[model samples]
Target: MKNRLKVLRAERDWTQAQLASALDVSRQTINAIEKGKFDPSLPLAFKAARLFKMSIEDIFQDEVSEEI
Candidate 1:
């Protein structure tokens, strides 16, 4: 799956560490997510969406292989 965490965070002028702090995760976790080296769990996804005031679909898209 692909995500827009970094872009959204950048739009808000937040550092990776800031985003992680807001989400109660480690900085490395945010960096990993931003780099597409890790995928968040459902709860984390919901938290990110809530923090950005966006819907989950707005930030995350289905894998191309899973798209119709």
Candidate 2:
């Protein structure tokens, strides 16, 4: 998935570590998420949405096509 995590973090002047701390995740996890190398679990996604006061759809986007 492609997410606006980096942009959102930048808008708040937050570092990866800071975001990680806020989300109760490792900095590497934040980095991986930002880099699109990893996707967060549903619970984690909800936590992030709550933290950002945005819906999960506003943050993360599904990049895969639905076409079979």
Against the true structure, what is each candidate's TM-score? Answer: 0.91, 0.93
Scanning candidate 1 in windows of ten residues, the lowest lDDT window is: 59-68
User: Global lDDT of each model?
Assistant: 0.92, 0.95
- Over 7-54, each residue of candidate 1 has an lDDT whose tens digit, in order, gives 999899999989999999999999998888899999999999999999
| Model 2 per-residue lDDT at 4 | 95
Q: Candidate 2, residues 33-68: lDDT per residue as tens digits?
A: 999999999999999999999999999998874232
* Cα RMSD for predicted model 1: 1.4
- Model 1 — TM-score against the truth? 0.91
TM-score, cand. 2 vs. native: 0.93
